[model samples]
Target: MRADGSGSGTLSRLEIDSLKAGVRIEDLAARYVPSLRRVGERWVGLCPFHDDTRPSFNVWPDSQSWYCFGACRRGGDVVDLLREAEGVDFRRALELLGGPPAGATAGRGWQSPLPVAVPRQSEAEPELTCEDRAILNAASEIYYQSLMTNAAMRRALQARGISLGTAQTYHLGYATGRRLARYLAWRHLDLERARCLGLLHDRLSGEDGANGDTSGDDVWEHLSQRLVVPVMRGWETVYLIGRATREAQRPKYLGLALPKEPLTGRGRPRRSQGIIVVEGPFDLLLLHEWGYWRQFELLALLGTQFKRRWLAHVGPDDRLLVATDQDDAGEAAAAELMAHFPGQAVRLRWPEEYKDVGDLAQAPDGHKIWARALSDA
Candidate 1:
């Protein structure tokens, strides 16, 4: 809502070029830009120019410019970085960098357009230690393997109309109590990491301990007869293990066993290509079935209720479409989604005769309904 166009003490191309050569791009970006993170040697962050999380936004310390792989496709020196991040132009960025003493233009407050308020991102994400990334990847690989060959689990997914290919693509797996625990231990995972990731738990005595022994119930508790769906943080499964209801369970639904901290520390990345927010897990799965899978990745809120904290995770350019059920509860959920996303959110209501995604999938115009909602762009 606040726009400052006054342009003054801008950094000269020569000075910016010098800074790029002198400072590490990651260091320079962290010092000037908030919320940007150090991915490897290069500094990566959400693209302020658009909503995306592809890690496509890159800052070159040598050139002192930034480039977003998403919509803006912008690439320039530090001047350009400031412009995109602050919604300013080169002159204004020069003023910001030159500081008030340099007679540059007056500076404006740095604030994100998203609803939640926070200090600009500080360069504080401890780089993912190799050990950490390895542990996570290993855990994920094992879980993924389980989803493939596990007999009971495969049957459960089939019953839910989910295909084997879907399970594999999402890296889904049932937590066969002993196999998962053994896998973690084999990888030399510390007790804390396994516990924090929600992969370890007590099944035997109902004792509250991380990495507890799994009995028949405990393995099933994490994934028993349920349809398992993995929520990946990039390539790693951060949280989420689900199961479909057993035979004829009235309120048929898949559920998530969130990590110890229900809200993980990381927030949504900026500069994602786009976002598709649906009410249930299969709604995301169903949308994928309709071919909106690539451009629009799905986010299942686990339910219809909107969490206020979720607003902070939204990217500026990201478009969120709500695909709720045709029932009253679905309508209520859709209203809540619009309350948060406003014009960016469109309710994907089904036809009068159909119920929800499940019914639509079973109905004749199912493909048409999917086509209508996805092409709403």
Candidate 2:
């Protein structure tokens, strides 16, 4: 835990050797580089330590070692890979691999001979005020009620494999564009605050008698005519993201003026195996619909970037099943995330025909396809 990796000395040589023997170097290397493919006896992939253009990273299962023949030009055992990828010291790496050796006491004064570095923390979400909570709660309720009555919207969702039960479970809603302003006024909520939160806009308001009346028709809903996906933390709606329903809509998604957080699923089982990370909210919804949530915690990145802040939800030993889209950007994002958690992440390999989980869900045997993928992981 110290900057100089001083605390690592407590672990005995036997403990370090046990940790090294328990983990396979080639298997650990594959987590950092998902593209690793077998070449005769050795596996090869692009080097994760640097910008690799060719297959210069080599992993030998026979020797339990890896070497990057490209830009990094370095090679070592599993411990070296963990230290390099996680930016931790020998003691920390051993701890991450499998805690202290049996019968080792924490009170021991022994120190690790190897040096260590401080691990980086992700940026924290901005603090939300009381007023912010009130506005978000009201907006979410109004949208939920709106979706209940909109038969067309319900039918649209059904066509996409999202059922009425699933929609209600996730608190999915529809934005009427004209409802929020009036609802906030009826509740005597501050319209200016809502505008500041990216829920309302004043582009249509004219420069007439400037009395600062935002509750009137002058203000417009920011997510009008789009499907609402409220990112909730327990009972509170922390963030709201909207997806365009119509094909003609230019921007596919929109969000409130808040830090982007992964849209998570409800009730993660106490003994869940790992986190199932997907690209879009729909992809997550379909997975839940097919009963994947029973075994794994689900998270939708909402986009390609995976922030370090999200790591708080993951347990130290839990694996990350990266099921992003099969496209170029998704592949790149998965690789980046895998590299961040070497030996603890696996890129879920989807069938080549399907571009993503959402597309795969449309097939008659979509559930089976996903089951097979998870089993392999």
**Which portions of model 2 show Cα errors greater than 4 Å?**
1-125, 205-216
| Segments of candidate 1 deviating more than 4 angstroms | 1-139, 151-161, 191-197, 204-221, 248-274, 294-297, 306-319, 327-329, 352-355, 372-377
Taking the tens digit of each residue's C-alpha lDDT, what string does model 2 give over 1-377? Answer: 22121264354333455556667777678778998987544577878999977676767664466777455656777888999988987667776676553335443434433332233364565677999889999999999999999999999999999999999998999998778889999999999888777787553213111112244477667688889999998889888999878765524676766677789887676678898999899999998888878888999999876778787767779899999999855876787778778899899986899989988888999778988998999
Q: Candidate 1's residue-wise lDDT over 1-377, tens digit each? A: 11112245443333443333433445545654466765322356655556654444556442244555445644665545556667876445544444333443433333322222223354542344566556556655776677677777777666556677766666666654456556666778764454433344333223211123234433222333345555566666544545444443212443322321121212333434566676676666666655566556567765555665665666666677777777655666676677668777777655678766766776667878767756764
Q: Model 2: how far is 49 from its true place, Å?
A: 40
lDDT of each: 0.53, 0.76
Q: TM-scores, in order shown?
A: 0.50, 0.64
lDDT of 1 at 14: 33
> What's the number of clashes in each of the models?
26, 3
